[model samples]
Target: MTFEFEDRKHENTQLPNNLSAPNPGHTHQLISIMNTQKRDRFELLSAYLDGEVTATERRQVEEWLDKDVETQRLYSRLLNLRSNFQSLPVPSAQPVEQTIGQVFGKIDKRRRHRSVAWGGAAIAAMVVAALSSVVPGRQVWQMANVNNSAASEPLYVALNTPVVEIPDTVLAPAHKSAPAQPAKLHQQNN
Candidate 1:
């Protein structure tokens, strides 16, 4: 059951001691307090139903149930629900030892399958590695045995720039005490 702000506000309209109506800000505080009270009351009732409540709390719940028709109906429904749950069949459980043995058996079976799968993968990898190395080695060997007649032709490289010899002194590194002079070279520019 829920109490809306409007319903609480209506209840406040009939306050004793000629109390004034709550201001807009105070209205929110009242609503929160009402919600908290309702939640606490329900928790107390649950504790009462579970036989976990102290005598005082039990009395409080009884009084609350007596005064509040909604609470009474709620308590009745909770009682019926609890009874239905208690009346349901309880499922039997297997022995703990047997259950544990089954779990370990399954784990061992999976481990065997995983080991076989990993072994097959390792063998496949070795085969692939052997094939890769053998193919490359054979190709290299075949290349080495090819005719050398094509390789006997003299190899030469040509450049467009004319070669000019500079004296070794001009190319030599100068002492740090005397600053180095740049080399002057003759060139034909295209």
Candidate 2:
């Protein structure tokens, strides 16, 4: 005995050709469904095709599709598009090395620019440090050695003072120096 898996009776059944055709008068129903912006006809058709809708929803979608020529055409186009994309060939090989080299070159260029900028900054900082040490106005204190008994003695002392002071005599008349002779002796005795 031989057994066949195909349903041979289905092929023999005299189904009407118009069974799958959209009804010419259902155009009004299709227009009404399309007018409802809440759910587009395409989405409804897709859900119905996927068997995701309830019995009532499925019936409504079927009726809408049957009535609407434009909706039916859109559904057919979507199905064709899906089939076309599914049949597309996938790429196998990738140019990974070339892509990596381009990325690495960009990275190296950026690193070099960054290093140059950092070197410039370091040089500027060194120049600023040198200037701070050498400039006259910034010298607020000095380490001085004091001599006692006319012998050289090293003394680490911080003297915080103005380098120069204007004397009252110097601000007075030029002859004020002669008038201060007696005061000089008094200062010496003190």
TM-score of each: 0.50, 0.35
Find the candidate with the highest TM-score and give its number.
1
- Residue-level lDDT of model 1, residues 1-190, one tens digit each, is 1233224324543334322365776677667766866766676777778887666667767887889998898899889989999999999998999999999999999999999999999999999988877784365434447788989998765476436655658665665455434442223221
Best model number under lDDT: 1
Q: What TM-score, to 2 decimals, does candidate 2 have?
A: 0.35
Clashing pairs in 1: none
Which 10 consecutive residues of model 1 have the lowest summed lDDT?
1-10
Looking at model 1, residue 77 earns an lDDT score of: 85
**C-alpha local distance difference test of each model:** 0.71, 0.67
RMSD of 1: 14.5
Off by over 4 Å in 1: 1-24, 53-59, 130-190
Off by over 4 Å in 2: 1-66, 69-94, 146-190
Per-residue lDDT tens digits for candidate 2, residues 103-172, read 9999999999999999999999999989888888675577797767566655555568545765767565
